[model samples]
Target chain A: MIHRFLFHDINEGLIRHAKRYVLVVIVVVITCSMIDSMSAYFMDYFGEYWSPIEYGINEFYGRYPFVFDINSTDKFTIPFGWVLIYLFLAYMIGDYIYKDMNGYGMYMMIKSKKRWYWWISKCLWCVAVNVFYFGLLWISNIAYSWMKHGDIAFYQESDLRMSYYGFGFDNMGMPKLLLVVIVMPLLVGIVQSILQITLTLIFNSVATMTIIAGILMLSCYYGSIYIPHSYAMLIRYFSNESDPDFVAVDAGTGIAVLGIGIVAMVVMGYMIFRKKNVISNR
Target chain B: MKIELKNISKVIKKNNVLEDINYTFTGGCVYGLIGKNGCGKTMLMRLIAGLIYPTSGSVCINDKILGKDISFPDSIGILIENPEFLNDYTGFENLKLLAGLQKNVDEQEIKDTLTSVGLDYNDKRKFYKYSLGMRQRLGIAAAIMGKPEIILMDEPINAIDEDGVAIIRDLIRGLVDKNRIIIIACHDKEEMDYLADKKILMSSGKIVKEMIV
Candidate 1:
């Protein structure tokens, strides 16, 4: 019976506190992904059609590659919008709990006998929101691929395996691309969501958002497992067979970094939230 | 259902919102907690609701410490400060969600509670659309709905009309029980005198007077 009530409260957290972000997450995810893909589309198809399409063409480098190619550094230009999804995703995790804390949170806590149940409910709702947000973006990537390439885009993706997609790095196959493009982003969203929430409880919302985004922006430069955001960007791990500056962390190492970070944040967040006073959000 | 306080002092940001104070309340009675704006009336209610912790003391219910033995009151109905609720949901929907927390009140009881507060049971209006008076009524309905043993209300009749206030007066009077405790903080001294079986006046977090009518 207690478990039923606990799950019911978990479901209530999703319906009340977390459901409103669906549109915001969807809009940001699709908007950022499309801008990156469409820029590449115009440069690849339009720029090529305007110049020349010859039987024997020696392309010096892939001027623009597909957005989900897992080797496209061209998408990293201009505000680094390729990683901009974290700007909203991190904010969602950072502010969702605090906003509700400032809202009807005290009333709900007074109703329930267990304060920890409220903390657990919010965490569950956040995970559900992160997974749904990333799943929607992954579907958008697949649709873009099917539209750009002919039918059976997976088969066509194999041809990109040996070619330099961007930054003189060899493109990965469809299976590996799915792992990098879809799965890695989902893990990153989960990790960032949990980490930012914990930080928000420890600090204020503005400071936490800035801190998470700053670390991620720094990862774009370092591309090291020490910076967890480096693993979120798939293109960082894939490199040309002949590139000199390529520093690749094995996929296991990348996953472990994010996975360990997530566990640590969950434990820390529970401790902080359990002790927090729900007094008018002060 | 008895409440006991032991040197309950809450200090926030170097300011003692509640100074060292001790009081006990028993069931089958109405408690009128009267005080000025910042006299720790609301802070006292919050400590009892387990929303905030005390800096130097403890609150116990029936000999069980508030923070250690029970995280919050076992079955409490509270409307602290401004009676915050989900703004997007309809009034009935909000009550229904809170009711699900304890599973003690059914749909008929919720509808009756709304109607008892003079709110339309079938009104589909969301909480954001309600006037200030209706919001206060809904807060009262939520507090007294599930038949909780303890009900703590701060400014329960604020913004209510004359007729609504009369109805609330009668409703509060009718809810006294041997095992049920009701504590209210309000600015209206006449209503407190008329409705409270015992009135406790506070000044700067210290109990100045305790009157048993």
Candidate 2:
């Protein structure tokens, strides 16, 4: 019986929270503009029609040949716009549990009789919202590609990627493209969102957002296999074959890292929320 | 059923919201908690509801320690401070949303609860469009909907008209059973006298007086 109640709460939390999808729409608009600029760049430079998968790869591709030298005179450029998509996504899912705890969520918790259930519900809520957000991004990219190119193709122009991104698709099949474009983004998004949700309990939303921004910036600057955000960038994948100046991480390892990250955040969030006080609009 | 609060005190930012409150609430009666503003009536209710943990003590419901043995009461409903719901949903829709969680109250029960609280279940207006009185009515309805074992309402009658108050009083009166416990925090003495079987007066976060009505 309790299991049923928990399931219903999770389902309800996800559905009811969809009212905030307006934030998702805002991010989607920003992403669409970013894609447009990238498409125009490829059109002008490569003089070739690119596929949707290539467009997605470029948007997630942070600075290639990234090297952080403390003593060097050259300043490292971070992708502020790319980081904003993550920040905005985090902002969208951030206040949900907090606001609900003050308002309707408290009532639900009291009735449900298990605080862990609430945490689990919010974790799943994060996953669902991230999936939907990334789904729209992918769909928007595909729609743009369909309008420009006549086919919904996964084929990539290896020469163009090598020249511009310092990486080339090495006989990348459909499965690998799907993994890089769709699965990697979705996994990284869920991991970061869960981390943000867990951190909001300790820090205020602004502080938590700063922390998330820091993580994203660090991910953009460093291409270490350990950094979870590195998986989001297709150009950093070893299978994709990047220039020797860049560090390459396997997609399987990225999946494992992000998967572990999601688990860790979920468990940590439940631990903090178990004894949390559901005060008024805190 | 019984709820025991032992040395229950809550300090938020070093301000003593509740100070060493030791009280026992038994079933089958209405408890009217009377207190002045900031005297910790709502905070006490929050502790009992297991929404907040007591700094120095514990709240135990039916021998299960809250925050240790259970996160909240087994079956409970509450309307604390200003009632909040989804702004875009109607009164019925809001109640339905909460009711969907427990699955204890059916559709008809929800409609009947709304009617008892002087709200039309079929009202088409969203909650944001609801007047103050209507919002209070909806809050009351939500608190009492599932016939939960424990019902906590901080200000169930705030913004209600005299007629609406009478209706709520009778509705609450009819809700009493041997298995239920209802705690209402109200400032009106006459209303407390009329509705509650026991009146517990509080000041400075302590129960200063307890009288049997």
Q: What fraction of correct interface contacts does each candidate retain?
A: 0.68, 0.80
Off by over 4 Å in 1: A1-79, A143-152, A155-176, A223-226, A238-247
RMSD to the true structure for each prediction, in A, is 6.5, 3.3
Interface RMSD of each: 2.4, 2.6
lDDT of 2 by residue, A116-197 (tens): 7677877877777787777767777777677667667866567666665555666566688678877898899999888988
Positional deviation of B141 in candidate 2, in angstroms?
A: 1.2
Model 1 chain A worst lDDT run, 10 consecutive residues? A51-60
Per-residue lDDT tens digits for candidate 1, residues B1-213, read 989999988878788888889898899998999988999898899889887788878999889998889889888888765676777788898888777766678999999999999999899999999999999999999889888899998988899999999999899888889899999999989889888999999998899899997
- Pairs that collide in candidate 2 are none
What TM-scores does chain A show, candidate by candidate in order?
0.68, 0.81
Model 2 residue B157 CA deviation (Å) reads 0.9
